[model samples]
Target: MEQGEFALSDREFNRVKARVYKEAGIALSEAKRTLVVSRLGKLIRTLRLNSFDDYLDHLERQGTPADAQDFINALTTNLTRFWREDHHFTHLETYVGQLMQRRPRGENGRPKLRIWSAGCSTGQEPYTIALHLLAAFPELKRWDFRILATDIDTNVVAKAASGTYPETELSGLSPQQMALFERAGGGQVRIPAAARELIAFKPLNLMNNPWPMRGPFDAVFCRNVAIYFDKPTQGELFARLGALIVPDGFLYIGHSENLGAGGGNFKLVGKTIYQARAQQKARDAA
Candidate 1:
């Protein structure tokens, strides 16, 4: 095939769509045909495959785990930046402040806080959470605070774990915020050790049932992730997230996304911010 001449037949496109949806829960519509071809074309060339059918056959017949991972990485979208949704961070600060004030110290004589940044692409969301919280509340330094940043794409998870980025990625950060990063030579900057220390990056697939973490997290940032799934998948995901969050704990989603009917377990408290209500309802029923 000539350069820039990748062609995906209708059958091939549908096959690709089905595989992606089944494996990743990403609903790729007919409109995404171009995207499928464009993203996968590079990968095909890299692997020296002649056509989509050949690649698909190889994937099903003899592909290794790494090959499957590369396919997912190629199709997965990881567009994100530091403080992309600034208001969510502001709400986070307020919520944490109130939580710190109300919650008593643990038996260990220190308070514990956990925030899960689900679908945290390339680290920004969780790092932003760590930086903002650490700066806004110095007391958190002495407390047991952790941010769990997980994404479906292993490649992005690795990048996020590095906690380093090109300097251009710092465009929106304030001077004070910028100060929290160290100059990584070659036009890159790294998240300061303070913020980096608070986060744990892991590769996770939301479609997988029975997520590993046993959480009653203080908050969850699952922003911009559910939009990729179909309605039923989205509903199931939000419901599962509700189960893991403590009553009154906050959930922040992407501005473009909404919980719709799936949000029955949560109450809308701010722009795309929800407070979990299931535990409270159970207590009331009791």
Candidate 2:
């Protein structure tokens, strides 16, 4: 057990792959063998395990809940930044403006808006959504608006909940956007309370059935997440998301991802943007 010397046999790799797929719906291909080794090697050594088999045994037989979570955290890839795909937000502005004009106020005499940022890594996407909404629709302060930001990685969820990031991470943001952040000590910037208050960060696994939230959301940003799943899983996930969104509600995905067969309930409206079909609303009402 020298550093970087952990040998992962085919059997061991497949075992890891199967477990990850089963638990998270992430289909790890043969190309991911190197990734698995690199990501888990340190964890295996930290556990004082000499081989992948021993680590797998520990995970299956005697690992604590924390150990299981750490395994998923180690394997989960979270790469995100503010305005990673700028076009989505641009479309969102137009969509929301139209939605506000058409949708009636709630019983409380206030406009209600709910947007879900599924797979919100490190809080950037959700925060970006909040910032954009606040900047474009200043009246949202008087409305009932909330963003539900969820991710499978507890580590990232916790970081996101903190609403803090290195100043360097804000490089892409404009001065107007930068004004929304307060200077956190140690060269970090924290999201202003106005934007932070609009977001609720939680840990969620998309693979889990009967998702805990009752949605019917105005919009859903599940960007870049379904790319990790195989075709069937992707279809099922988008179908479920379709059921949760209101008719005419927007769904923004990653630029690289195509909804494919899963897109039956939505119609393409903009680049990587979709509108949940009005027929869906009729079906739900019926």
TM-scores, all models, native as reference: 0.95, 0.96
For model 1, the run of ten residues with the poorest summed lDDT? 277-286
Off by over 4 Å in 1: 1-4, 278-286
lDDT of each: 0.89, 0.91
Error of 1 at 95 (Å): 0.7
Count backbone overlaps in model 2: 0
> Which lDDT tens digits does candidate 2 get at residues 4-107?
67888999999998989998999998988888898899899899999999999999999999998888998889999998889989888988898778778889
Error of 2 at 265 (Å): 0.5
* Residue 40 CA displacement from its true place in model 2, Å: 1.1
Per-model C-alpha RMSD: 1.8, 1.6
CA error at residue 120 for candidate 1, angstroms: 0.6
